[model samples]
Target: MAESRNEPADPIVRGTFATAKQSWADLFKWKQRVAVTNDYGETYCEWQSPRPLRNPISLFAQLSARDWLFFLVGLAAWTADAFDFHALSIQTVKLAKYYDTSKTNVTTAITLTLLLRSIGAAMFGLAGDKFGRKYPMVVNMIVLGLLQVATIYSSTFTQFLAVRSLFGLFMGGVYGNAIAMALENCPVDARGLMSGILQQGYSLGYVIAASCNLGVGGSTDSWKTVFWIGTGLSIGVGLIRLLFPESKQFIAAKEAGGGHTSSSPRAFWIETRKMLAQQWRMCIYCIILMTFFNYFSHTSQDSYTTFMLTQKELNNAAASRASIIMKTGACVGGTIIGYISQWFGRRRAIIVSAIVSGLLIPAWILPTTERSLSATGFFMQFFVQGAWGVIPIHLNELSPPAYRSSFPGITYQLGNMISSPSAQIVNAIAEHRTVTAVDGQPAPAYGPTMGVATAIIALGIAVTTALGPERRGRQFELAKPAGVATADEIEVKGKLNDVESQVAVDGEKPDVGQMENVIVDDDDDDDEKKR
Candidate 1:
């Protein structure tokens, strides 16, 4: 006897593992919502389910060459951003000696950088949304390069802190712009894998910093060399961005909105206020999710080198080497887990990775010797960053319509602001407390401190991610105003000048009744397939 329909009714309620499992199956079996805009031009969206996940090559092949350029440049920019920040973090011990201050005091710079990033997120993120992703990022990247050099010449600790604070401000803007540019153009189904590879740019930057640190050997002045390298890298990325055109999605969205990103200050403020009104709850929820993630990474990573030095009794070179390997694991895990998330579902991927990483806390910290510690640390960060891989696409998916740059950027960095003291807190606790080490000697207890904090943070990430909203396979393409040609249909496709002129000539008041395709779809109106 065949059942009348193959699928069960949508779960009456949610928040259970069984429910989540059922929903995962539904992602494949049912027709997911496809975003559609009505004549009123409201942000409400009705979308269809996505096609099945494709191979990495197939997914990548769908992108135009223009898309690849944007993604690669965005990744390069993010990598440079990571290097600039990690230059200080990995050099904490030497910086302490150079400044003649305690490691806790030195981490204050990290705190300041994190604390003020929200401001940059608000300012630059809004600019990216309103103006475009290009110029704001150019300004941010170039300024960041200059700030790194300022870190080199500071004669006093206070001056160093000031420069780093400014650095944080500029740095705050990078993630939002970079991620938006990178993933905004990617295919809906491929974003999971693309996001994973993209996020590893951070880890890649960290690895570059560590490698440079290792090359210079352990010296009080060696950190400056790394900063100089960062200066060049940042400036180079800024220059490279000049060659690329603005994101096609951003263009389509603006054109869809009648030829401007926002036509006037009054309009921009009105839109911002309206978005805030509709999405306040989602905003608060994302901030909470990002808070847990920020804590997860900073607690586990920022002090690990110091932990090895103080508790495990490793030298600077050995510690740096192990760190390189650990983050290498981060790169590998992020890519693999990120790719898998495409088919597995975003929340499920993040939840499982977080849980496994939490369970691996013991193996991560217990090893005594260099080889053993390296192996353990590598495995530990694999899961730590595996969860992180999904963040770029996840945040983009959660962002409100037309505010991708500002919303995700602000929330993410706001989380950073809240968790700014993570490294400082870990250091303050570890430096003062003592626990038995693998050698049976009483040590600063760095391992215990990081382990407990990361475990709690991991659990928090899983729950927050589970409870939050996901818009996987949501569309970023918008309908063209009637009579306006699409990007492909442009006379000189992919040329910046040709596209702008076309937009200027063709974009005008549309017949609201005739308009089709919309980029900014906030909620799925009939998401029965994903239920």
Candidate 2:
């Protein structure tokens, strides 16, 4: 009877060579039967059996259909955000020219926009956690679209700055909400790819904005036309999202009383306090590190590239064209890095990209002709600046589902808050390097100073890599499984069980509540029925 039960049923397995890799079932059975004997001449079986095979067909089908829709929504939102943000970069120089202001002053407008956007991101993140992602995303799109349209008619520098700053606030909400939507909707196996695809919208938006700037012609009205284009795009995205459904996870959370029900200010604060107290440390660390590196890359590349092009004496038209080219490189680089990170592992990919790009930064400082400078700038932006496209997805994975949006939003915004100032600082430093020649031409004094600053920041990042844990290929869940132990749990359990077994196996007194089985019925059940 034992021989019949143990007989190899599958001929494919029986005919395999001894050196062939073992099947999962064969390996699992072997592991179950093996027991290590201690010095005391006693052996014990491993607790818990292997899990049963899960049905992949149903899981794959559901994830495939749902994640695609989620990806589209994320893509649209991010693309709009990218268009709104990068459109302003080229426009800033134009704004400086039109208002008879210094580029430094114009750069301050960019800083204000970023600062306000960070505020929006943080606020909306909290709101998304409190309420839900869908409403905030829809509201932000409407707000940003209307604001972009309003930006077109601004006459004065203050008006433009105010409008853009307000737009930044709305833009901020889009990111956190969109990310939360994507993260919650995607399957575990495809989260990285979905996140990457969604983030590609930023790069794609840059491309679209650049094309618009170049295609529209760099008149004073050209920037305004670009803003109108952004408004239209945002409206389209908003309308598309209206047709899309809310996240299943979010809906389930709301049904389970895991989300807010009241609108009182005090109640809001209490909920915020609870979230912060529970996950503040992890949230803060991840946000600071990820955002610092992300913003550092973007500000250094996007802002500095425009600065460099203008310094090279390119006209607004030429510079805008060059900016478009740089943005193209960024798009390509972002797409490549996003996909590569999936294969190489997110942390390793980020570290490697940072290191390689850091090495390339010094090249920007090297003396080069206009052609060489443009080529080098494009390469740097594509590889170095593009590396940031993966951080959002990686950061999202590290956070728990309940606090996912809030945590990434806080971390991303806080990092942006710290790093946005670097743009102004870099501009200030670069300004110091400018010298007026005898012929009345302003010459660039520090050719590669921004690159040097970036390299230093990259070095800091290399040191801080230790602070982040490896989350690649790990399943993201609200809580770890209870009875189904992980490897880490098994090790800890073995240590505790060894101690407990020593007493129990030797007929010594057991500790209080040490028995495996314990049952307690709920008194509340009867009381609730009586009530």
Q: Which candidate is the best by TM-score?
A: 1
TM-score per prediction, in order, is: 0.83, 0.73
Across 113-230, the per-residue lDDT of candidate 2 in tens digits comes to 7777778887888777766777778888978889888877777888878987887777777777788777677766555545555666777787788788878876765677888899
Tens digits of per-residue lDDT for model 1 on 358-444? 999998888878898889888888988999999998888778767888888899999999999999999998978998876778989
List the RMSD of every prediction in angstroms.
9.1, 12.7
For model 1 the local lDDT of residue 382 reads 90
Largest lDDT belongs to which candidate? 1
How high is the lDDT of residue 240 in model 1? Answer: 92
* Residue 383's lDDT in candidate 1: 89
List clashing residue pairs in candidate 2: 287-411
lDDT of 1: 0.83
Model 2 residue runs over 4 Å out of place are 1-63, 255-271, 365-371, 435-442, 477-531
lDDT of 2: 0.64
